[model samples]
Target: MPAGPLRGTIRVPGDKSISHRAVMLGALAIGETRVTGLLEGEDVMATAAAMRQMGAGAAKHADGWRIHGVGVGGLLQPAMALEMGNSGTSTRLLMGLLASHAITAAFTGDASLSRRPMGRVIEPLSRIGASFTPSPGGTLPLMMTGAPVPVPIEYRLPVASAQVKSAVLLAGLNTAGITTVIEPVATRDHSERMLRGFGAELEVEELDGERIIRVRGEADLTPQTIEVPGDPSSAAFFIVAATLIEGSDLTIENVGLNPTRAGLIDVLRQMGASIEELNAREVGGEPVADLRVRHAALSCIAVDPALAPSMIDEFPVLFVAAALAQGRTVTRGLDELRVKESDRLAVMAAALTAAGARVEETADGLIIDGTGGEPLRGTANARVKTHLDHRIAMSLAIAGLASQAGVEIDDTRPIDTSFPGFIPLIEGLRHSS
Candidate 1:
């Protein structure tokens, strides 16, 4: 499908995770928080719109995005339902932020997001004194009434989820005392670090092989200028494309390399891919570097389950790399994938199989047999069902690039949710290279 090698220097969108947190935290600060390099994706725009609806001042300027805050516990009741579009992060985090305030709001999303569970956040927020009336099966299209006098308590995560951890921490922000979260497995620490940056009293300690995070509630926040970095998650498609396509030598610039989120790079390196880190630096409290990737012969290996937290969102694309590798790639301990935007495990397995690769779906993970680096002759007239999941659409597009015939997706509209202009970027690289 690809005309030739994809060789170029490019930068993906700003970190989606960081961009979401910045707007939320900035809206709770005392003054204007200016953010440069904010992602202008539909998902993030939904968060910003929700913030604006709740009395935060959000507007785009010639320089960047400027958000005027109303301080902690200052959110106003929205006049309409908060449309979340497709962002689980925005919904869960906002539920926590609203849990300790005295306002009531309704949360709704598109069909894909409506199927994902919100009970993970609801259980903790309910304990913090908020009340929720979720749809059948604890999904969205729900009403949440904030606790006028919220209670602070210690919560232990029943599962490994950064969203769950962040929800509890955010609810603790407007509470009256110290609230704590005990994480059996560490997820991303963006919330913890960003909380401290915005002047919340927070502490982290490791005891008995678990992480304990505590935050003082009802704290005042200070606004600051934030320089967001390129997203590594958005960078994955091109990274894998460059690695799988012959003669590809691509340099992706300013990708966030947070240690907690770099497991994909590690796994690819273990599978014998050529990725070199250049210009290592730190921006906005996160490590970042340029990645120079070249096409190389890949081999299969069993992925470490513990690394799942770091690379959870990446497994879909990783499945593509594995399908064309030299042996069977065994991935396990991915039970969490079942609860994402779609059942990523099942969707990716089916998509790869339809594209002429050998992929077996397992209960918790996927078992994929590689083509030993041979380009797949894609199945004729069989299109990939993306299920409105953006990663699936993009990952399969990359598969088409490395195949004799192009992969066809049911829809590419979902690609704009996170990585807008994705097709243009790929086309630019294809023609210029």
Candidate 2:
């Protein structure tokens, strides 16, 4: 099979992290929030329904989406269990939400999500008068009781997880006093920034190499319009495609360049990718920019562990870029990747080796030996197993566009979790090629 090239401009979906926060914050606010460019993926949609079940109103607008908040500390009891669908974000954040409210609710999800650890959020939220009924090793499908009158807490994170931090901060929104989180590792601050953007009094301090976060409780949020930028994670596939595929020049517009999530750009640059940032500016208290990428000779470097929290979602595609580079790419600080939608590090190693890249697995990461800028040639029918992981599916699909025999992923349905327009985007690039 002859390998094809990627071309054309494709606007990816809004950032999944941002989309989740918008719905949640809007649900807690006192008025309506108009959200433009909302990512309508399953995870986000589940959050929308969860908000409605909790007595918050989310409606469709002509140009964007809208949410009317139920007021701070104003959540009503949900009639049924709030099904989070395939979203780890929803389940985690809701843990914080339920921890502060005076209600009892059960959370559930699909098979893949059911197995993920909820202990991270459960442990911290439990510190502030919230209780749980029998979760097996902190897994999902557990009944959680909210403290109708929550006690504000000064919690500390064991790891740098934005979800964990955000969960605590949101729960604090309704407590009697300030809620705080101390972190040795700094994850994305979108929640902190957006909380301030919506008129919440939040503070951040650094001490002893730890970030101390505090949020004022029992607040009222002012409704504001939100324009979500295209997701940088979604753009990772195309960025890797442009780097590995020759004669490729592509520009992705209006991508969120939040410092916390721009590690892939830095890693690609370190690997000698011909990437440029244009139209850098601030929108809605967060940065926005356009990314221009073209083919470049890449040499692998050791990816440091400290950078894992920032680009955690992009590692699968980054592995694809490593497979196309000339040298070995060794990554550290990615034990978290093992417990994502799939064991992504192992999944990438096995899938890339099957496509003719030399890859080795370690305790935390992978080492890939590239073909000296040579394209991979494999059997015509080698199928990359996605393990029902969306990122893995999208990464393998992008690899198929650059491989020698042209790859086919075992499942493409999972791509809708973040990039619902993936097939059409790929098809568009194929047409231009």
**TM, every model:** 0.99, 0.98
Highest TM-score: give the candidate number.
Answer: 1
Q: List lDDT for all candidates, in order.
A: 0.93, 0.87
Q: Please list the residue runs of candidate 2 whose C-alpha ends up more than 4 Å from where it truly belongs after superposition.
A: 1-3
Clashing pairs in 1: none
| Candidate 1 C-alpha lDDT tens digits along 181-232 | 9999989888998899899999999999999999999899999789888988
Q: Model 1, which residues run further than 4 Å from truth?
A: 1-3
Q: How many angstroms is residue 145 displaced in model 2 relative to the true structure, after the best TM-score fit?
A: 0.7
lDDT of 2 by residue, 185-253 (tens): 999988998899888999999999999999999888988799998988998888998888888888899
Candidate 2: the clashing residue pairs are 102-148
Question: lDDT score of model 2?
Answer: 0.87
